[model samples]
Target: MEIGAYQDAQFGQERTQERSEGSAGSMADLFPKLVAMQRLCGSTAFAVLSVHAHTLLKPGKIECTTQSPGSQEFVSPFLKLNTEFLLSHLCSSPCPVIFMPENAQAMDSSPACIVRNQAVTETSLAFPVQLGTLGNGFVMFFDARAMLSNDLLIDLHRKSLTVMREKLRLAFGMTTGSENLNDREIECLQLVGNGMKSEAIGEQLNLSVHTVNAYLGSATTKLNAVNRIQAIAKAIRLGIIA
Candidate 1:
């Protein structure tokens, strides 16, 4: 079935392969940025994970993991960090958290908490970045030394946000200001993000289904997304909608 030129299977394996390739390329290009971030904070390694949001309330169950070259060994341990708990915290706040070996256990409710069974040797600093519907996840820098100073942490946050946005644009081919969505297009996308179908949206907006679809199609193209879902995701991430 198709909805506003979007095939239901657009999200199937074929699209998954395309997204994977895009993500791999994007990370390769952004690896330098990650390295710079590590150097800025005196960390040995870094990792970035994009969590696919299924809904506003549901915990992100799907993940795409990427890390610095030669950091393969760290991936296993990195995943051991209470991801479900960590992600929940990241989603709630945009701030980064510090995790150290000495305090990680006692600070269970702290910004960074490791699972009881997990053994982490290094201190880690993590912060969440919003990538809209494409994927939203956190970037973490790991160091064997002590935690960063307040000055360094502040600078890291500023730089990390810029890097994350660039990653999102590269991974998903999002172009800033390349196309503009008008009032109707933005309205349609906002409703869709809220889980309203075309029919319901049409009724609510007092427009015909075809008109609603037209608006969505235009919005999708403007956002450079492959389909309605992606368009909605991109729009939300771009702050074009709520």
Candidate 2:
């Protein structure tokens, strides 16, 4: 995420440098790139929203930029840009948020309620972007046809997210830049997400159960999750594991 955030600023710099091409152009200037990134991520729709506040009652009014002109017509059915539960994550890390249909469907939690209440039935990725000078922004990718994962979407995600951040910062003003997770911690969480028990994860990683638990505990602490189940779920939501 640190790498992705850096890439965001770097990409933002490049785009700003090229802004002399057209000061008259609107956010539509980013349409083509949004379309390109949408294809790369296999998303049904891609949007960048500038968030003003992070309160439960007010998600802040959003200035949205989408791929196709008048595409909010297409996006309206799948998501409600402002909801209390959704706004809850804005004050957290500047990492990606993923909602897997299967995982989300099985979890009867507040977030699941938000997803269901909004009538979203597919996978989605949300990148929380906050720049000190620019306020707050969110870039969302919705893939309703199937479930999405970071492993398969990492390259696409990194590039797509970087470009969205740049486009948002340029279109909106302010420059930007998450948690620290080591390989072992991520590995253990991934296996746990795959429905593996700690012992099974240990066997797969060739580590003892105690070591696997330690890694899980460390990841949980880093993620500020309550338990292994919460850790795995948060890991999935944060794009730490597929």
Candidate 3:
């Protein structure tokens, strides 16, 4: 199937309206059609990651789910292990997913491996989904036994990108550059990107550590990073902090 066709199938206006009006608390509710698409493609698991926040947050940094060879729990350690490694290794050049395969080693010891291995073996393929303003991330389907065909993988990847675009818009309240980041928050993040520790930044800026940390915290939320380190990474990427 054509990539554009797959995106239209997954996103289109109808699904967007549904999600906008519905609760996003449950991944089930957020991605019912995507789950169906994964099954249709014969994928064993469907996983999503926010590459930007991987290093800063505990595992399950985003959302991941699967169906086959038994259900897997979304454990915190599993979430942290996978996300931290992916963030550390995946670079922004050529988009983030370019680094995923080479960096699979980062996830080698994760409990999610039992399930992740199902799709990341030598024979399996991974695809980069351009989520636009949501930034770069991957949509992977594991078939340890090679049960899926290349054609299907291609189609699935295309559809996954469309699904992800909408999912990210909803998840992050993403807008164009018009979505302003507060000046204080941006200033704090700029200091952070300069490699200044909170105390050092506080002294340099003539602010208390507590106030500096508060600005960092607000920046973290605005950037959608789980903590200060990831916040710095994101700010740098968005050019909000130089």
Residues 1-242, model 1: lDDT tens digits: 12212212221332333333433245577778678778877877788867765577875562537677666576556666566766676667555666656534443233233333336666777766664666467777866354455445545654565566556656556564323567788788889989999999999999999999999998888777799988776776653554
Using lDDT as the yardstick, the better of models 1 and 2 is 1
Per-residue lDDT of model 2, residues 126-223, tens digit only: 66655433435666777634434433344444455445444543553321111467778988888887789988998889999999999989888877
Cα-based lDDT at residue 196, candidate 3: 82
Model 1 ranges off by over 4 Å: 1-27, 54-59, 62-64, 103-118, 144-147, 176-233, 237-242
- What TM-score would each prediction reach against the true structure? 0.56, 0.46, 0.37
Candidate 3, residues 135-212, lDDT tens digits: the string is 556565443233344344444554555555545544555434313566677777777777789899889889999999
Best by lDDT: 1
lDDT score for residue 66 of model 2: 50
Clashing pairs in 1: none
- Superposed by TM-score, candidate 2 places the C-alpha of residue 226 at a distance from the truth, in angstroms, of 48
What lDDT does candidate 2 reach at residue 16? Answer: 43
Prediction 2 global C-alpha lDDT: 0.57
